[model samples]
Every structure is written in structure tokens, then in C-alpha cells.
Target: MESTTADWVSETRFGKWFLSTETWYREVLSVALREMREIAGPSMPPIRRLLDVGCGQGRSFELLAERFRPREIVAVDIDPLMVRIARDTAGRCAVPVTVMQGSVKKLDLADGSVDAIVCHQLIHHCSQQAQVLSELFRVLAPGGMLLLGESCEEFIDTWSVRWFFRHPPGVQHSADEYVRMVRDAGFGVAPRDIRTSTPWWSLWEFGILRRYGLVRSPLPVTELLLLARKS
Candidate 1:
């Protein structure tokens, strides 16, 4: 339960529990990975080692293994509680899994240590977003891919989400800004490599009213998905 000195916000209790649900795996994690795979197309290099930054509950382990078929997975979460649960999840995977509790702002990884990085739905929780991105760029091998996914400011500012989840307030970004941030961090992200989605789950009222066909706001881009490669 102890927090790190880094400018990171640990997930709320509801947020943490939701991460273990089938809904998260199916709707969020799997979808993002699949989209990034499509975005990468033939450009994605052979991935031998992958680093899963902000790997909550290790939910992405099996999917990362099955999709990328990496030789090893190194997963880290800032929260110690999530790390313990993720360690259990890691053991269930077919691939070699290493779970650690650490902040992404200052990763323990050596420079150019990983062939790929899966950093999904993590940046908004970080106030030190640029520093975190810098570390991601640092540990990734040249030509390695970064599968980055995030909820844009439009989605993160929704009342339902604001009530249930925790995030660094001032650092929330729009889809374009998120794209620019990654580009500024030294990753090579082209326009074709970026994807914007407004999944039903990201709808206002957490899609409850939308599911009932009661209300509709001007649908803005709520999610940003991209495949950035180290140059």
C-alpha cells in the first residue's frame, strides 16, 4: 500500500478490481493489442523480450505472449498490491514471466534492454508523463515497437469515470496531444500508425445511457491507440 516517490497515482479500489474482470480483457486490453498489431502490420520487428509497463494484475501477459510470442515478459506495476497479484497472474502464463513493482518514471531496466514495450492505459495516471515516455524510449531496443493505448481527456474527464477511477488531473491529454507527446519522446509515429476510437465502453455515463438508447452526445475521439517504433 506504500506509494512511490514518483508522481504516479495508484488505481482506486474499484479501478483495480475492474482490471481483473473479463470486461477489461475483452473490451480494452485485447482490443488495443489487436489494433496495434494491425497498425504495426509488417513493420513490427521480431520481439524476443517485451516489457509491460504499468502491467496491472498481469492481465496482458498471456495475450502478449500469444500475440508477440516473446521469449520472456518483464512486467512492472507501480503499486505493490498489483505487483503481488500480477506475480500470481505471471505464473499462469506459458512464457517466462518476471513481475516487479517499480515506477516507470525511473525504470530499473538497462538501456535498450527490451525488444518491445506494451504500455496501455497507463500514461494518464502519471503526472510525469514525459519522463515516463523517456524511460520507455530508453529501454526499448532500436527498431523495437511500443504499443501505446490511452483514454483521451474527453473520456477521462467524464463524471462517471472521475468518480470511480483515479488519475493525475492536470496531465490528461487529447488524442492529438497524446500523439504529439509520443512523437516528441523520440518514437517514430506516423499518421497511419495512429488510431482513434470511441468504443461504446468509453461513452459518457460509462455507456449505461447509451446501452439503453437514451442519450447521445457528439461522439468525440475517446481513445488513442498507436504503434511507435524506436528510430
Candidate 2:
């Protein structure tokens, strides 16, 4: 089906519901954030000038602020409504964050300006995933990091979940394909893990893709947690 940007953003029940409630936002997204931090390591410099691509309602930014204490946080989304809601939600948080209404395929940021770029559950929504990855690579600094959390290719096997995501914007990739994409974008793979964290019977994948090569593993991973650094 042809999915417009509006249809993808406005029709997302989870995003709308997340913007409306604090509890659901905290409960559902916190696990991913915690795991990201654990993999990112505590000794890393406090993330400054961070960019969250496709940040719906800025929930992840809210969680990241409490743990990492970034100096500047920017959240971008293609939908104006999502950006508006994200700005409002960020306003309620302890730290200041900027929300922009823009597409990940074309971000409004200077080259090598951001220290970290995060695209959580957002890559799947892009029809031009490679273009988006290129843009992400372009805006990140040499030592910057890229964190991606996405649905696994295995998710399509389930009939119920498949129906919910049976749209053009919903694209799932296998672990090997994702790794190749990250490397092709000029980043090396780092430490990552793919495991089921949700209580639901559904399968999901989460990973941190970095800009540099720090750690590598041949272990089979369903949902990737990659950390790639720019070379």
C-alpha cells in the first residue's frame, strides 16, 4: 500500500498513546534505553549535541537525558504533528531539547556536528533506508556513534503483527543485511546483542550501530545492537 508520511505518523497508535501517557512511555521504552546504555558503557563521555532521528514524541530523548546528561539534544521527524508533540514532551523534561519537523533522508544539521545519532524504531519506517543511512553518516562526526533499534526480519513470520506492519514504510532487514548497510555507510560494527526483551509473544530486534570498529562478534544475532564509529 502507498503510505504517505502523514499516514505513517498520524496512524501510529503507539506514538499517539505514548505522547498521551507517562507510564506507558516509561514502561515500554525504558528497557531499550537501559540496554543501550549498558552496551554504550558508563565511562564514555557524556553525550553532547545528540541527534535523535525520527524521534516520535521524544520519549527516548527523555530517557537518555536522565542517564547521559547531554548538553544539547535534537529530535527530528517527518511529521509536523509528531514534532509538535515531541517539542511539548521535551519541554516537560528536565533538559532542553530541540524538535524539528524533517525527514531522516534529509536532516537539517551541519556535517560532523553531532556526537551521537540515534534512530530507534525509525529506520523501518523509511522507504529509502539506504539514503537515510547515508544522511546519518554524513552528519555524524568522525568519532561519533549510531544507535539503531529496529524490528527483526523475523517479525514478518507472525500473521497478526505482519498485518499491523504490512505497509511500505515498514521495512525489516535480516541481521546480515543490516550489518552490510552499516558498513557500506562507512561505519564499522561494534559490540551488539539481539534478544527478545518484550513480554509479548512478538519478536523484536534492537542494536547500536557505531561509526568506528571497537568490538566484533561472530555470534548469531536476530536483533542487532551495533556500535559503529566513523573512520
Candidate 3:
């Protein structure tokens, strides 16, 4: 099915290639999952069916299975190439996975169909961020959880990222704004549910100066990881 909205940006060649890299799997994806799970705490929901939005190359599949052990997984991405490649990756996952090519602005799934969702590093590329969140809220079951991970405006607005990636212009948001956006979309985002950080990879210099103690000041939060639950 065709996406009802065209408010999405295609990943640049470098961005697409980066998604498949070991660095992405280890440093970015794995770290995000670990942190999100930590923030979710002991009350994290039982995920019978999980929806992974923007499941690039399906790298999160095995991690999701290991972390949540969901009975089934539904992975969606706007890129057909990623979708096709992700299908191959999905086949290797222990959990049953269905990878589909579609936009999160309008998921083809039924209302309240999923127990959990992983929207990792996806909002920065979409113009209709609110619409995407609303769609996610609609598809999620009541009491379901949404693990939302994002590179906040501080990181996405940088020259290196701008030059190497293709994002919808003027749509980036700060960490606080991101939390508010999810809350405004009908999810419950308690203060304790939020996590913000400036990871080494998010730094323009890859945190070299910070590692050497040349940069002592705390940096603006470049990462936003949260667990918002539908009520």
C-alpha cells in the first residue's frame, strides 16, 4: 500500500550505508536499546507483538528478540531497498517477523494492534512528526509502551550530519520538545520515563576533545530516549 503522506525524507547514500554498518549496530542501535530498556525499568510491558518503525536493514530484530522476547515482530520502513534487505534479516531472527514497506505517518496495521513500538532515530527525517506520533498512538494498544529514541535538534542540526544526511528541513526539535511532542500525542511521558544524553558519537569530533578533558562543560543533549505509555 502507498503511504498517504509524503512528509518523509529518503536517507542519503551515506546514511543508508551507515545503517548497515557494525558501528551502527554496536554503538548506536545497541546503546539506544540498552538505555531505553534501563529507563523502562521493571514495570515495562509484556510485548506480545512489537512494531519496529523504520527498521533499517532489521538490525534491531535480534536485539528486540533478546531483550523483549516478543511472540511476533512487525517491522516497517519507507525505503523499499531497506524493506527488502530487512526481510532477509528478519528471516534470521528467532521471533516471527513481518517486514513491510510503508510510512509511519499512516501505518497499515489495525488500531490498538501492537503491544509495543520501537521508534528509534526516526523522527529527525520526517516532516510530519506529530502525525507520525499520532499514528503510532493509534496503533498501540492501551497500556502499551513506545520506546522512542531520537537524535535531538542539537545533533541533527550540526554541519557534519546535515552534510551527510537528508532530513526534512526545519523539523528538528530539542530533547524537551520531543518529550512534549509525545505527551501531546496522547502518550503518558512521566519525568522519570525520559533520558537525555550527549553520546560520544553525537559529538562533531566524536568526543575526542571531551575524552581528553579539553571540553569540560556539559554539552547540549543530543540524544533523547524515552518510554511513553499509552493510556
Candidate number achieving the greatest lDDT relative to the actual structure: 3
lDDT of 1 by residue, 1-231 (tens): 745354877677888889989999998999998887788686556788999999999989998898888999999888988999999999999999999888898889899999999999999989988888999999999989899999999989988899999887888999999988898999999888888989988875666787677876667999999889898
TM-score of 3: 0.95
**lDDT score for candidate 3 against the true structure:** 0.90
Candidate number that wins on TM-score, 1 or 2: 1
Stretches of candidate 3 exceeding 4 Å from the true structure: 1-5, 213-217
Ranking by lDDT: 3, 1, 2
Please provide, for model 2 over 77-99, each residue's C-alpha lDDT reduced to its tens digit, 9 standing for 90 to 100: 87777777788888887778988
lDDT at position 134, candidate 1: 91
lDDT of every predicted structure (CA atoms):
0.89, 0.68, 0.90
lDDT of 3 by residue, 194-215 (tens): 8888888999989898889988
Worst 10 residues of 3 by lDDT: 1-10
What's the CA RMSD for each of the models? 1.7, 8.1, 2.4
Residue 188, model 1, lDDT? 93
